[model samples]
Target chain A: MFEAVYQYRDQLLHGLGMTLAVAIASFVIGFLIAAVLAPLAVYGGPFLRRAIMGYVALIRGLPELLVIFLIFYGGTVFMTKIAGRYIEVNALTAGIASLSIVAAAYLTEILRGALLSVAHGQWEGALSLGFRRPRAFLMIILPQMMLRALPGLGNQWLVVLKESALVSVVGLEELMRKSVVGAGATHQPLAFYLTAAALYIMVTGVSTLLLKAYEARLIPHMR
Target chain B: MSLDLFLPAFLAVKNGFLLTVAITIASFALGQILALPLALGLTSTRQAIRVPVSTYTFLIRGSPLLVQLFIIYYGLGQIELVRNSFLWPVLRSPVYCAILAIGLNSAAYAAELLAGGIRQLPTGQWEAGRALGLHRTALLLKIILPQAYRSVLPAIGNELVLVMKGSTLASAVTVLEMTGAARVFVARSYAPFETFLIAGTIYLVMGAVFGRIFRFIEIKVAIPGR
Candidate 1:
C-alpha cells in the first residue's frame, strides 16, 4: 500500500541519487572521451583512424551487459591483484565506468559525424593562414562542432539515463535494483515495478522537456 | 589459469548456443511483424491513431529496455490479479515475458526506422503505382515495402544486434540462457574473467556474422559510395 511507498522513501531516494550520479558522471566522461576521439576518427592518419574505428566497432558491437560484467567482476579481481589488496567493485563505480565506456563508443560516432559536417574548406582556410591542424581544431573547428552535435548528444543523454538501469545487475542500488528489493520486501511486484516504470517515465519526461527547452533557445542561434 | 586449458569455455558455448539463437530469432520475427504496421500507423496522418502511436514510441524509445523488461517480468509476477487470471499461464513463463519485452522494445525502434524508410520513397512512385491501378494494399506490398526495406535494412540490422544483446535481460528473470548460464559457470568455476570472456566472445561472433549477412543484403540495394 501507500505505507510501503512511504517506508521505502529513503531507500528509493538513495537509489535515485546513485542513478543520477552515475548517469551524470558517465555521460560527462563519455562526452569528454567522445570529443577527443571524434576528430581523430574523422581526420587522423589511416592507422589512427583504423584504431578508432576498431574501437567503436568492438565496443558498440559487444553487449553492454558483458562489458559491465567484465569491468565489475573481472576487473575487480585484476585490480586487487595489482593493488596487492582487496579492491572491491562497488555498484556505483562499476556503473559509472562501464556506462562511460559503453556510451563513449556511441558518442564518438555522433561527434565524428558532427565534426565531419564542418565544411572541409574551413580546414583549408585554416591551413592557408599557416595554422597547424591542432591549432585550427582548437581555435575554429571545435566551437562549431559542438553546435552540430548538441541535439544528438541530448538523445544520447536520454539513453545514458535509461541504460543506467542495466548496471543494476552489479547490485547497484539504483531505481531498478531498488524496485526489485521493494518487490521482494513488499511482496507487491506489480505495484513496485509499475512505480519504477513511472519513475523512469517521470525522469524521461522532465528531461525531454528540458532538452526541448534548451534546443528552443539555441535553435535561433544555429539558424 | 592456463591458456592451454580451455575446455570449460568450449563447453559453455556448446551448452548456451541454442538458447541464444532461439531468443534472437523469436525477437527478430516478432519485431518485424509488429514494426510494419506500427510504422504505418506512426507515419499516417490520422490524428487519433498518431497520438497513441507516438506516445508508445516515445515511452519505449525514451526509457531503457532493461527497466521495461524488469517491469514486465519481475514486476508483473507480483500481481495478484495477473496470478489469478488465465493469462497467468503465459505470464508466468519467463520466455513469454522476455518475448513481450523484446517485442515491445524492437517494435518501437523498428517502427521509426520503417517510417523513415517509407518517407524516403519518392512520392512519384506512389503516384506511379496508383497510375498502374495499384490500391493501398497492392501499392504498399509491391511498390513501397521493397524500396522501404532497402533504406531500413542497415538500421534494422543494427536493431538485430541490439536485440541479441538485449536478450541477456532474460537472464535477470531466472532464464538459464547464455548470460544466465554464464553467471552460474562463473560462480562455480570461480574464473570470472574466463567465463565472461567466453560469453562476450559468443556475442561478438554472433554480431560479426550478423553484420556480414546484413552487408550482403545491403549490397543488393545500396547506393554506391560517392
Candidate 2:
C-alpha cells in the first residue's frame, strides 16, 4: 500500500514544489495588485471606487474552477485573435492568472478593511509633520496597515495554497495531478491520495504556526 | 465571439442547473445535520470529546476538497472491503460520493462556526437556564442553541455560497452539474466562452437568490434589541 508512495516519492516532491511555486507566485502578484487597488478604492474618486467594487463583485460571484476554465480557454482564443494564429495558453500561465485574479479580489477587500481600521488621525498627523501625501502614505501609513492586514493575508495565503490544486484540472503537474497519475499507474488510489492530503496538511499546519508566531512578534500587546 | 451559441448553451445546461441546485441544497442540509453534534463535541468540557472533534476539523479543513472528493470517489473503490460491503451501492455512484465528500467538508467549517457562536454566548444564559430547572439537554436546546445559531446566521449564509461554489467540483467526478454541462457543450461546439458565460451567469443568479433567502431569514429571526 505504502510502497507505491516511496517508489514515486520524487514525483510527489516535484509536484509539491510546483504547487508551492504557483501558490506563492500568484499570491505575491495578487497582493501587489490589491495593495494598489485597496488604497485607490478607499481614497480615489467615486467613479474609481465604483469600478473597483464592480470588478471585485464580478470575480467573487464566479467559482474559482470556472474562472480557471474561462481564462484557460478564453485566453487561447484571445491570443489567437491578437496574433492571427492559434496560440495555446499553457496551464501554468492560465492557473497563475486566474488565481491571481481571484486572490486580488479577496485581498482587496481584506486590505480595504485593514486600511479603514487605521485611524484618520494618523493621516492628519503625517500631514502636520510636513510630509507630502505620497511620502506620508509610503513611510508611515502603509506599514501600519500591512501589520493589521497580516492575519487576513495569512488566511488568504492558505486559501490560495488549497486553490492551487484546481490548477491540476487544466493539466498543470501539481500535487493533485501527480497523485492522480500515481494512483492510475500504481492502482492504489487511496494511498496516493492520502499521501497528497498528508502533504497538504503538513504545509498548512506549518504555515498556520508560522503565521501565529509572526503575528505574536508584531503585535505582542494584542496577544 | 460566438453569439449564436449563447441561447443553445443555456438550453443545454438546464438539467445541469437543476443538478447544481440539488447538490448544493442537499449537501448543505447534510452538513447542517452533521455540524450540530460536531459543534457540541467541540464545545464539550471533556478532553476526550473536544480533542478529537478539533482534530477532525483541523484535518478536514487543512486539505483541499478536490483531494477529499477523489479519496472518496476513487480511493475508496480501491479497497476490497469497501467494494464488498453493502455501502458500496451508494459509494459506487459518483454523485453520491461528491455529495458525501462536499457535505463532510462543509460540516467541518459549519462545526467551527457553530462552536464559535456557542463560545460567544454569555455564561449567564447557561446558568440562568440551569437555575430555571432545565436539564443539560433542555438548557442547550431551549436557550443556548437558539441564540448561538441566530448570532451565526450571517456566517451560515456565507457558508451556503461557499458550498454552492464547491458543488462545481462535482463536475470533475463526472456528475454533470453546470460546470460539467458547460464542459460538454464547449467540447461539442468549440465555444468555451459563450457556454461558460451562460453557466457562470446561472451560478451568479443562484448565489444571489440563496443570499436573498438567507437575508430574509436573518431579518425574520433577528432579536429586537441587543
Top-scoring candidate (TM-score): 2
Question: What's the CA error at residue A27 for candidate 2, in Å?
Answer: 0.6
Report the alpha-carbon TM-score of model 1 versus the true structure.
Answer: 0.93
lDDT of candidate 2 over A72-185, digit per residue (tens): 988998899999999999999999999999999999999999999889999999999999999999988888888889999999999999999999988999999999999999
Q: For model 1, how does the per-residue alpha-carbon lDDT over A1-223 read when each residue is reduced to its tens digit?
A: 5578668878887888888888999999999998889878987899999999999988987778878877888777888989999888787888899999989999999999989889889889999999998899888788778888888998899889988999988898898798788878887766776677777878889988998887787748663
Per-candidate iRMS values, in order, are 1.5, 0.7
Please give the DockQ score of every candidate, comma-separated: 0.70, 0.86
What RMSD does model 2 have?
A: 1.2
Off by over 4 Å in 1: A1-3, A129-132, A219-223, B221-226
lDDT of every model, 2 decimals: 0.84, 0.93
Residue A165 Cα positional deviation in candidate 2, in Å, after optimal superposition: 0.6
Fnat for every candidate: 0.68, 0.78
TM per candidate comes to: 0.93, 0.98
Q: List pairs with backbone clashes in candidate 2.
A: none
